[model samples]
Target chain A: MSTGRKYLLQNVAPYGGERTTVLLADGVIAAIGTDVTDDDATIIDGRGLVLLPGLVDLHTHLREPGREDAETIRTGTRAAALGGFTAVHAMANTTPTQDTAGVVEQVWSLGREAGWADVHPIGAVTVGLEGERLAELGAMAESKAQVRVFSDDGKCVHDPVLMRRALEYVKAFDGVVAQHAQEPRLTEGAQMHEGIVSAELGLAGWPAVAEEAIIARDVLLAEHVGSRLHVCHLSTAGSVEIIRWAKSRGIDVTAEVTPHHLILTDELARGYDPTFKVNPPLRTQRDVEAVRAGLADGTIDIVATDHAPHTREDKDCEWAAAAFGMTGLETALSVVQETMVDTGRLTWADVARVLSETPARIGRVSDHGRPIAVGEPANLVLVDPAARRVINPDEQATKSGNSPFRGRDLSGCVVATFLRGRATVMGGASCDEDVVARA
Target chain B: MKHLLSTGSLSHKQAVRILDTAGQMAATQAREIKKLPTLRGRTVVNLFFEDSTRTRISFETAAKRLSADVINFSAKGSSVSKGESLKDTALTLQAMGADAVVIRHHASGAPHTLAHSGWTNGAVINAGDGTHQHPTQALLDAYTLRRHLTGGGDPSGRDLAGLRVAIVGDVLHSRVARSNVQLLHTLGADVTLVAPPTLLPVGVEAWPAEVSYHLDEVIDTKPDAIMMLRVQRERMSSSGGGFFPSPLEYTRGYGLDARRLAAMPDHAIVLHPGPMNRGLEISADAADSPRAVIVEQVANGVAVRMAVLYLLLSGNESNETKVDA
Candidate 1:
């Protein structure tokens, strides 16, 4: 392990400022912009590297405890580290269903033992994801994992009563209810985003209103109950507008747009390929512009990679029958760089705040998304901002190859990722860490 | 064509070829023996992931009439844990050496998946897939419409040029409605989609058709034909804020009853892709009427499917000369 060893990162620029030297030692930042006197310490050449706080994914589906064929904490966090994420909130939709305190603790521990990244468990809002009754929210909130986020991702909390109650219950422990905002009845048998493309393709349409309506309702409910509400994977322009309006009114609401949603649109579904099929399906270019404007203006709070992983069977099939997500952990940063930073829609400082600080705040992961200062934990990533590469699925870190952005040339390759001073990834290669064997 | 996934993409020339070929297949069915030696050595598979006895039998008959070996595999009950059934089923069909796979799945784009996934070297014919499309059904409907309009002749070079078609009821969830609207438009027909404001999709205005809520107004237009789409009871509580008050209300407003049928043009016809709802979308009186042509649509389904199978599988690879023992 690279822990306990001093390192000098020379002439690297952090997201907000000019180039400066950052010293890492004893699992924390020893100094920034100062010459160190450790003669035996390592020296890392960061002349051309752009450093950012380690990416924190508020939404990730590390399919563990069951369905490990797709992804596990060990591989998933490694992929996360490759994408420059030091912490990821594992969603509650697992085989046993991460609804209880016990399940969340197990997932949290698995991530800890993996030693690649910190994995905070998101408790399920409803038991078994049935949406009929509430899960033990208080128990999960007080569990060993200290799950501060609760969501029934993949399945929407459709019932107004259930949604309001979930929003209310989570507020007691300062937990935020991350809602997958979709109206179930409207989206029944829905294949893709309802629009001109769906009309032409003849596939059943998942209208933008299905997501917007729920968000409109939830924001009101959150205000009524005086609680914080987080919207997951906000896709449509109408959704962004509603969230913006709610935020303007001072409703305790924050919204996130996934990296896939930021760049991709519904036109990709023209080929009838299942790879493009996702929940809150991709919308039109007009909606895409609206979301981009929303993100640039800070109406949308953060960039989340609803990083769902599915096996080939789950994705390489009919669009309607396919699973509803893309593997985003390894490709999120590149996507953001191409769509946001490269487009001049957002700066590296904006990227830092959205990808790390804001998400960590939403998930209540205080330890992961800290500033690049002396005495702070060394959770950071080094990016060759000028480098570009076409994404190859075979070279991906995820077990699944369903990267929706396959073959697209994207810039900003992650060269190294450090989790509390230990380099999980160094120079684009994984550093060998003594991961605990399965007990 | 490698696949007949949807009528949405089928060109006017290709559609006319299928129709003209069906004219020949329909002639074969009128003969004493419907069997042919054209596909004697070929193998065709009917991979149905959805339960549709009518469509399954129609395709099976189409392949058998051409003397091709047929394999009927129903993957109805399998381990559908995250859509593995489709992949496993597709791989099995690939290994079975089936020359063509006629697939009918509940999901909207299964045939497109089967064709483009490269799981098989065979051709793909979409029988019906979710609410997305049913190209064969549209072909048969077009075949029936053309035959009824101008008396049985070669529609090889013809399009439904001056024909006006009104597709009534549940346009939101009806694959039949979607496929017909596209195919009919491509054939140079003017289509008016008649539905409750709720039944039509949000972006129907973008489709190559005009929309109307009143069936009587559509009937008053004296259209060349009125095609009634099947209305599902489940869609009432869902799609568009409760589409209708009740089944009776829907039948009264849009149902093709005797009065509405009488309002159509004298030479006009009525088409329904069944199993019919009895008195729901179309009344029993109208369905049993001589002008209905619903039965003829079923009979033409076989012929259209035969034409699709023949065109897909009867390339130069066929022996073309086989002895009848």
Candidate 2:
């Protein structure tokens, strides 16, 4: 539908390069070789930039049609794009959630209208996310929206029989059920991760086994059903072990870790700030390292932003009274850079793989997470890995101001983001004009 | 900031601040017109899914005293009894314009689920969940301890440093014990749990505090306070054990009888997470003793909850305003 010549960076090395150029035409990278002359081509310098495949998020909570005060599709997608993502799977935990074909279509249409990132609406595994009855999974998978991911994300699909059925049912469409694995009985009164911190804090303990138990059961179920199961926001070391064992057995199970879980520990709960409160509540330092090791050793498949947003009122309370989520969209990459890259735990290529390529493949997003090569769609990001900035919630794009990283200094800045050869973010600021034009 | 849910997430500093602020709230309770305009424009909904007398009243009284509009929604005889789900009830509350919800349910993680499930934008405060943690109860108990043990100086400004507390009786089913153990430990108090093996919950060794089987042995340690938990008779029917030979035997051994009371240091106080089984766990004399702060604990519950609410909600706002200025 459109044709234009755009050069990204010329003579850039593949993984570690200081300067490079990529020429784009008709939404794909036209060339990547040394300087070529084109009369009407736009030239953009890509010096000191590492171009990555457009990022993909397997777990994102785009709260829309309900709790719009916290976030909406337009705002959430804009945040995702600014964070260098080209595709994101919208979690099916909204009010009047995406459990049916109708709801899935509504979310898909909204994403299409927004035109920022490719939004794949995840259908709810259970009706109303109650975990009692199966939703119309077949109909949702076959809908115009073409749902490929089903999840009771905010709540675990705890019933063994129901989980098995949901896993087996999605096989027809090659869909995956992203499970929020927590055993209900084990975490009955749990307010935070159960450990020494929980005991000292006197909060009800949410044991790691609660999450581990379900992961073990579901991974076994996935093997039995011969279907794909994606573990959502795996929090503990024990969960990492279960996922590792599942992967070793060649079970079709993939696990994701949130940026917060990789960086934070339950010791933050000692401050009694509710911003630290989260589902699959934050774990100990040992668990934090285990998640890092999991991410490094390939036990964890992807780094997904469980970009859960909650209002100030939801989080500004006594530790026990407050809500259990913090805004992550704007901070995920910065955290990953700080915790993983800065610490020398992962290379830039590893970052591109975990944050983008692998996630897109897992969610089956065709247009995104492509290698930054000729003929591939120009869904890409240019990052300045050395830039450092302190997190300010007030400056974030999300409507919610419940970020836990407030005032913490983080490195790595997303200089530019391109979705389908169109610049969504340039010079480290979102292209408001382009976004408005897309809308 | 909105409501006191469980004691688990509180830090020593935050717990101390709540207790200190509670002291000021307690001072207000003695005033002629005991109400503040802090939360005047806010609407607090008390949604009790389980039957409760003291906890409900404490929250209601706290909200009213803070000048917040209060809505009482009890599950008994309400639409909840007609099989309406928690989600439906939350939606109804949201429609009714609730700013905060104070919920008590028989299910342990129901409030946590409601708060995190995106069902409503309103803040959620767990009043009590099944065998979870009762945060405000711990707050009041901490407040009571500070007042009696820490002298006229505000105990809230500091942690419960150097204080030794012994909690005796049913730990298995008592949410009160769970909360107190957490809050007291955070406040730097040395806590000892005294309960029979049958009465203690599994995995208690994982707890931060010490566990003892004999109250007499615990009394020899000369604790700053001895909190006697009410042994719920209902649990006896469920567990199917003569937990003691009888109630009389419990009174003779673990109960805060006069002899055990005498064994305590002169300044050691008596505490009970009340609806006190007066003669069963504590004698009338001990309950009414000058050193007993049981009633004071109940009165302090309101002030402590008010402090928790004030610190969590208003403190952040004030801090932000200062930062802006």
Q: Chain B TM per candidate, please?
A: 0.94, 0.92
- In terms of lDDT, the poorest run of 10 residues in model 2 chain A is A1-10
Model 2, A1-439: lDDT tens digits are: 2335364554444454545567777788877766654556666666666788878998888889798999999888888888888888999999898999998999998888887787899999999999999999999989988999999987899999999999999888889999998888777656888766665445677888889888999999999989999999999988888888888899988889999999999888866677899998998899999999999989998999899888876765446656778888778888888988889888888998899988888888888888878899988887878788898988888788888899999888887777788777778888875443463
Q: What is the lDDT for A232 in model 2?
A: 93
- lDDT, candidate 1, B115-231, per-residue tens: 877888888888888778888999899998888775555666677887889998888878888889899999998999999887788778888999998999888889988998888
**What tier of docking accuracy does candidate 2 attain?**
incorrect
Question: Compared with the true structure, what per-residue lDDT tens digits does model 2 show for residues B211-319?
Answer: 9989999999999999989897665554335555677777777888888888889999999988888898889988898889888788888997787666655555445
Candidate 1 matches the true fold with a TM-score of: 0.92
Candidate 1 off by > 4 Å: A34-38, A130-139, A158-172, A435-439, B28-34, B76-82, B150-154, B232-243, B316-325
How does chain A of every candidate compare to the true chain A by TM-score? 0.97, 0.96
